[model samples]
Target: MVIPKMAQMVRCRIGYFTLKCSNRVVPRVFLPLKYQRLCFHTSWLLNVRGKEVLMPSLSPTMEAGTIVKWLKKEGEKIEPGDAIADIQTDKAVITMEYDDEGILAKIIIQEGAKDIKVGQLIALTVEPDEDWKSVELPSSTSIPSAASVSVSSESTESATPPPGQQNLAMPALSPTMTSGTIVKWLKKEGDEIEPGDAIADIQTDKAVMTFEIDDEGVLAKIISSEGSQVEVGQLIAIIVEKGMDWKNIVLPTTTAPVKSSAPAPSVSKPAATAAPAGLKPPSSGQVYGLAVKRLLEEYGLSSGQIKGTGRVNRLLKSDVLSYIQTNNVQKVKLEAVSPKTTKADAASRISAAAGKPSSYEDIPVSNIRAVIAKRLGESKSTIPHSYSTIDVKLDKLIDIRKKLKVENIKVSVNDFITKAVAHALLECPDINTLYQNGQIIRIPRVDISIAVATPTGLITPIVFDTVSKSLPEISETIKELAYKAKEGKLKPQEFQGGTFTISNLGMFGIKEFSAIINPPQTAILAVGSGREELDSSISPITRMTVTLSYDRRAISEDMAADFLAVLRAMLEEPTFLAVKRARNFMNQVE
Candidate 1:
């Protein structure tokens, strides 16, 4: 058949048939005959002399990303699988790779630029011999800017406000929350709700927080779906005033409401299109990406051999680097390396010629462990830490615990120690200060962080206003906090912003171990188990060693010593604690 002028045609011959295409590009053309199973492949390769490295979609819901760092600079010769840059998505910082081997000709976006949209040109790569200066970039109409993408993403819903309706928009739960996921809706449609009612539970970037309402109304309609991510200031639900015609009022079809500063009533629209299937995680035993697979092959390793630390146990480039550094393995030809060369074998071989397989397994660092490593590294490298240890007689505190137990009130030695530390902080306010922004901030209330060990890692839960709370109150609070912490349910406010931290390894029978100072806080006290010793009067005495790690920038050695001395006296003489309690009791009675 003849082709139209608007259509482009190409003809190819195979055996006795002629295959023709009108306008569409076909991969393989077939004939309608007895030999219909026979097909001919087409040679229609588009000329791709250069390629634009667009901002990649790192996560399923990642509309835009921030350039954390550039791994390859301009004029660098990059291979097909080389990492070009690191993109900071909503979930994590992932390395972006170059698909074609070329010379990085231009860097269009600088580092630290936020909200760069996917498919926006971030860099240009050209053949080694091609002059990139004459390359014509795509027009702005073809590829929208990052700002346009951001605006489009923000205004996915309708902008107009519904008549006479109250919109309950998603609030910025935390200072860092730009978007939040709806965990669950506490109040459903047609439910009568009053002021101070918790409408929903929102999972922000930091923690899950309750969304409370301040207006009295009937929950008319739910806008956003549960588990749907909604931007801050976007309408999530609608409420009607109590006196309005509740049953007869016709609700508008759900249209996603645009983000607004005020409570602009609007309907919800259909959710955004789901991300492509390529964004889904790989199946079990499969490598994460081409770059990761190449790196594994370069080192003659299998995907199952290296531990993955990425989300859902996906192996990342960082995990490979960590493995290489930890094992100190040299990259060799894949054919030269033995197939049975495990991580332990590599470590043992690096340490000594006699390959006594290293008795260690490579454990991928968890998210909490990685954060701990980074924060502790920063603290140790930047802050000047000075430690001092003091041994105090714990006989009085032990006797007090025994007496309290007999009164049907259970108390531990650590309880008295925490009380003593709080009292000493009150006496010496200088120790209760934080070195921040070139100033020593003296906290009015003594908020103490108690280190609790969980299965994942060590977490410190804070007890606020410790100086004012009674010993029993403090003991009960610590128990509650510890339980929540071990269950991984402690809120951000509970674990963050402490004036002091106490790490008691006494239960583990550890003796006098100094701890790294938790940042923003000047000092941390390390407590050891009590030991029995003979006193000068030949009587048995119980003593414990306490080591204080202080930031020299915030407090001097003399100040830290004086604070420890006061703490020692408070624990040694139980009378001070008794007198303080009696005075408070008498005031209450009066």
Candidate 2:
């Protein structure tokens, strides 16, 4: 805790001080001045706070975040690059680092706080000249604004989702995922699950994928039922370690974990002899658990259809689930759902935003789609984009594909194109780079982000180390990645980063078109439909058109042209790849 008391030179360089905590992230609350984030680097975000430190936008899609825990205590000395706290963003718990010399004076948002808006004051810091104890919330902050009041009101809708209660929050399976739906819970409440066991099938913005447990525990409670949509970082279930008294676990509440005001009063446990009620039920009449009630309503079933298995006719969630499974029941119509959430409510909200009843024609923009639109719109507007086109002769590549198909090594032309791009990148390393924070970084390995369009929006899943993979391997990898992308099952690692991007509209019959560059990456290659043309010898030649979109600041036109030239030659003479694969195989045999 070093505190220098020099008022004259008390430099406030805290924009970079991050408390090195378990969860730290350079949030995106940085000001997007002049379409800047679309340029490169979202970490060093500087927002319009003037001089006040505010809640950071932890991720690109994160509008608000929960304060998971503070790593530094109030009055603690903070150094540059010191992590101060762990913040629960839209994705996960990321550490927040500060880079200024200051003392953490006060934490405006306490631990266990949720829905802390971006730009909201989370803490107060003071330079060496100031007394840490005397620091207070500034007058100009939005704490008194109507937006802040509305945000404060929303918290009363329900208790803050309990953290450290071993509650399983919705994990961000993919980096871009904001929310997910529980497709199914593999294990019911009271069932013990091991670290590797498939606990739940979560349907993310990307796909329905298994969420495996990472700790040995008994799933004591399932908060979100099947088909229940929840935002990422929102709790869905509760787990307790083996031998723990999970049965006595207090139901989550606002007052369970009290703060500086008073010690939390112990919540008296429900009686074991009589019927035990779970989370507040939807209604008073004979309802079971909240999820159980939702399932019952979803299937339009009455209590008479299923028998309660718990003590004193208390219906366990498993009982309702079992009944639905046994009967193969279908969900009731949406209109049959609670009338409180009616079309009129939705229309009024839409009308307020549009100044007219626009609900009839408007389709709600999903979070994933909104992110895509924002990033893409900014990329085109800010970057100094340059484009170059080339026609690659693919006769030999097509012949190689046919030969491989006969040998049961089926592959696509796109696979060969991807392989050629990888090899071309190897020879033209100048073009195999990314532009970040005004610096161009050359990546050693080729990680190709293949653009795959899903029903929701476009996603790019990476084929890492693409240069080292065989054509068949690349084909299979792309196929699997595409499938996962379409199903919304792509993991963060599969789609997070890449050295270059490739978008193919060849199959869509587009003769030629340019693609927008995926920011931070140097360039993107757009492949168009293949066509037949007469050669100089009056012989037919099959050629495919490819347009390269690159950041002119990072890659020169000459470099882009050289890369395309190498790619064209490699495809025209496809034996280089085949020979390379054969040599590698022979070396293994030896």
What does candidate 2's lDDT look like per residue over 276-341, in tens digits?
122222342443544456666655666655677554455655566566555555555565455467
What C-alpha lDDT, on a 0 to 100 scale, does residue 517 get in candidate 1?
A: 95
lDDT winner: 2
User: Which lDDT tens digits does candidate 1 get at residues 1-590?
Assistant: 22345243323334233334565543454434454223222223221234678888875445677665688877788898899997776445679987788788777776545667778788878786555554434435234332322221222234454565666666644333456778799988898888899889886654456777766889887878797767655567778888775554444333443322222113233212211222323334843653456555554455555677644455665565566555544444444555467776677677677655566668955445656677889999988999999999987667666666665667678888888899999999999987766778887889899999876678788888888887778889999999887765676667756789999999999988999998778999999999999999999998899999999999999999999999999998865564443443332221
Estimated TM-score for each candidate: 0.48, 0.55
Give the C-alpha miss distance for residue 196 in model 1, angstroms. 2.4
| lDDT accuracy of residue 475 in candidate 2 | 91
RMSD of each: 22.5, 17.7
Candidate 2: what lDDT?
A: 0.70
Worst 10 residues of 2 by lDDT: 256-265
Worst 10 residues of 1 by lDDT: 269-278
